[model samples]
Target: MRYEEELIDEVREKNDIVDVISSYVSLKKRGSNYVGLCPFHNEKTPSFSVSRDKQMYYCFGCGQGGNVYTFLMEYNRLSFVEALQELAKRAGVELPEREQTAEEKQQADARLTLRDMNKEAAVYFHYLLKSKRGTQALVYLKDRGLSDEMINQFGLGYADIYRDDLYQYLKAKGFSDYQMKESSLVNIDTVKGNYDKFFNRVIFPIMDINQRVIGFGGRVMGEGEPKYLNSRETILFDKGRNLYGLNYAKRSRSKSLILCEGYMDVISLHQAGFTNAVAPLGTAFTPNQAMLLKRYTNEVILSFDSDGAGVKAALRALPILRENGLRGRVLSMKPYKDPDELIKAEGQEGYQKRIEEAESGRMFELLVLYGQYNQQDPESRTEFIHEIAKKLAQIEEPLERQTYLASAANRFMIRKNDLENLVNRYGLGYQYEKVNEQYKTPPETEERRQEKKKSNKNQPQRLLLTWLVEHPEMYQYIRAYIGADDFIEPLYHSVAIMLFEQLDNEEKINPAAILSRFTDAEEQKEIAAIFNTHLKYGLSSEDEDKALSDVVRKVKLASIEDEMVHTSDIVRWQELLSLKNKMQKFSISRS
Candidate 1:
């Protein structure tokens, strides 16, 4: 019913899945299917397959498969609607306007309002920083040794100490008080009911990956209890997810990512030509942030404040980096309180030397340092060892664990044997392995598990689908014997059913025809990923068909077993009653 759905269907109807994917992959026609290397994961052999009659794709190596929409979602990392719109544009399908629900309309309106407010706030603060009102802030930055270029690159700004200044500015610009409050740009007094949270402070805009200003952090210029104020959580941003200067860092280099503790540190470092640097926005490093870093580079350098708190944060972050498969090192600078000061006091050269000379301390050493600094004694040591052991256990490599065990033993002055034994006692490795195994089956408790399972189970069927789309002539031999209903898994079954019904109804097969019928955005993406996986790795046709048949049979048997279990529960009582009645009849007849 939607425009993208219709457009996708048209594209699928006109184009052959194999031919479309062939543009991306080098495919060879092997009887009924095509085979290629899988694009999802790094593999040498060709396990990806496409079926001309099925209009689907499957990657046997990685078990990735779906339709054209799924292909785009995985390859391009585009959302469902975005992928649909893109594919539609490619296929020359004109789409109609979509109807928005009431909730959708409201959310859209709120987002627009928040975006406008953030832009206005950013502009106002930047203007203040340049004007006479911001003389103190300018002097503050100058004293901190930040260059004009650095300030501009970071879009640093200032907010005056006037009550309701931001409120008034936004109000005149047509933003309501409610919008300002919701935007987190200004705060309302719980007691007085109206106030600005960021008065008399230098403001720093928090940006997302797309460089959209999502939130702000304000440093109090004068003597204040807190000294810093950050924007509350909003729709566009979470303090944990948005890293400072990552948008800039990701663009410059891909070799190494520098994780700093503060925005000023990142800005100053970037100005010093250390461009690959970013910091979490007013929060500790999170797993999401760690995963984000992994995408850009496996090598990471953690540079926190030289204070105890900074060291502790680095220690906490070590296991996270390790867990995410990041090659990370901790840089312990002079106890100069903060990174901005050290960089300012000692020029880039000095900081660079310190960074290079930094000792590569394992996570356990950092934790020991943390414990020592915090003065955690006897009882705390017990809790501490358990914590550190758990963190160490997350390291999946046996060699890596042994390496860290030595480090832990040396730092704690305990025997290497005792420490190694303690680390093993925690069972962190076993827990991680269990979790890893659970992940292989697509997590049963996950809300989307059914879809994930179907995707996983129907990889071979997807290959057939892709081949059918690319080589429709192959459909004749398989059409009568196979239909969508034959597939046990929904993804394969659904695609099969769609193809069978379409060809049966229309008396012809077209890969692009039913794309529009895939209205679910998530499913569309799954299909795109599936297709992209196959196309990225070209495969031969015959092998694809054989793989599909084998998987289909396995899935059907599993489905039958599942049904038998369910039916057995229902018939259990009837069997018991029948046996009892037979015994009674036998006894009565004998008497």
Candidate 2:
């Protein structure tokens, strides 16, 4: 069973849509609604709109629209129950105790069990690190300049060389073998039952944003085949979705995040007073990680190693940051290997100086281009100028693009006007202008408008859905005349079925309530677009009835035509024709 309807209603009543959305988005008053840049997608113009009266939000740019519950679910990546629990707390509504379903209970138990196992394992590893067995690992950490306080604070530990050391420890702690295997801390051995996953390694506990130890990273103390081994993906841990040291970095409250390469680099940076530092979990940066950073900071300073591989990784991350609507800067940690080495050699103050001297995304790209081509060679220089100009032309802001163009011209010993002419001649300027205009409207809204211009094919079906949602009382009247199968588009048919179902159960049939039926974000956005586009026209009660009848006729005619195409028999084809004629007659009579 879910939360009581009364409790859900109470929570919804207290949490106004506008108020809830304004916390994440800077909504500006526009008519009776609010408009802001969509948090779901990157865009310069404000296509995300909120309707206070309707308690719904729709982004014209990315097509993300839903109620406050949906906003929490999508924005925070929470489950429905999780979103509900959070909103109830914020709304000062107490959620009544309800017995969890078998599946819910099982999932909850699994998460708690895995987390407990990880915590216990971390404690055991820490204990071993302080014991005689970990003396070598402790000395190694000390030699690397990690103070005792840093070691204790980071919960650094050491795994024993014996495969069954942690397994026996956890077993003694009353954890079952199944639980151990599930935690990814132990590997199941066919003959031996279970063995520790990490052996003779330094342990680094990987915590979630909530500070719960969800997983672990183990680094081989000395020479080993695999230098570092991270926890496998589990229910509580997704390496692509979670960043190392974010739990601490978020507490730094810095305006910018220092993105590093590895776990040690992040820990070392934090030790050197750069607390707002995070790293991916033994993997290259991902789009999900980029979006996660955008939630915390507006800008990211890429402090990857200055080595060739690190440079390539930093270059690859630039576009991901841009696509996620986060500004990026490249930190050139030259004359050193990584942040850990740089901090050790130059100290925190020297590292701060390097951060300040970091290059902008465009300038960094130019620098990378310059490194690839020697300036003395005329052919390489020409190719470099053309490539740099193309990059500059892609810059959306005119001033920023012009500044970069000037910098490129000065660097290449060419006139600024000549570069500008070249960029314009390449048609990059026109393409940029087109993209800028496209961002002003939601992609779905534009496509719908273009579809309308192309033909009146799906217009009536879309109109029927909008009218039914806006006027739920008409559902019964419309149901008497037509069924969901009459609708041509699958999306429209789905919406029609949901609308009738909600009305049949005597429930509210607004966009928010209707959207809750769908789990897919894209499907919810599509339904929102259906309501958002047609509702703007403001059809009256009398107009709604007439429009509904006309649309039903059109939908029935479209459905019949579709059936006729498959009707090979002359009798079946004639039957479809007669059905279409009957629909036309009924529509004429209703009019």
Which portions of model 1 show Cα errors greater than 4 Å?
4-113, 187-194, 359-394, 402-591
What does candidate 1's lDDT look like per residue over 1-591, in tens digits?
344444556655665577666544545666678876555654434567877766777775555776676666555554556566676677777667887666657766887788778988999999999999999999999887889988887889999989788888888999877777788876767688677778899999988778888889999988985677789887666775568898899997447788988878888788888899899877778765776786688778888887768877987787666655577777767667666777777878877877776656465354554455433576666666666666666566799888877787687666777667777877656676655753353235665676568667566567666656555655655565445655655765676777777666655665434543565655554564544444323545655555444543444445444445556565764654554444233210101
Clashes (candidate 2): 2
lDDT of 2 at 205: 93
Expressed as tens digits, the lDDT of each residue in 387-441 for candidate 2 is 8777776776788777888888897678888889887766566686755885463
Provide backbone clash counts, one per model. 56, 2
What is the alpha-carbon lDDT of model 1 when measured against the actual structure? 0.69
* Cα-based lDDT at residue 527, candidate 2: 74
Report, for every candidate in turn, its global Cα lDDT versus the true structure: 0.69, 0.81
TM-score of 1: 0.57
Cand. 2 TM to true fold: 0.75
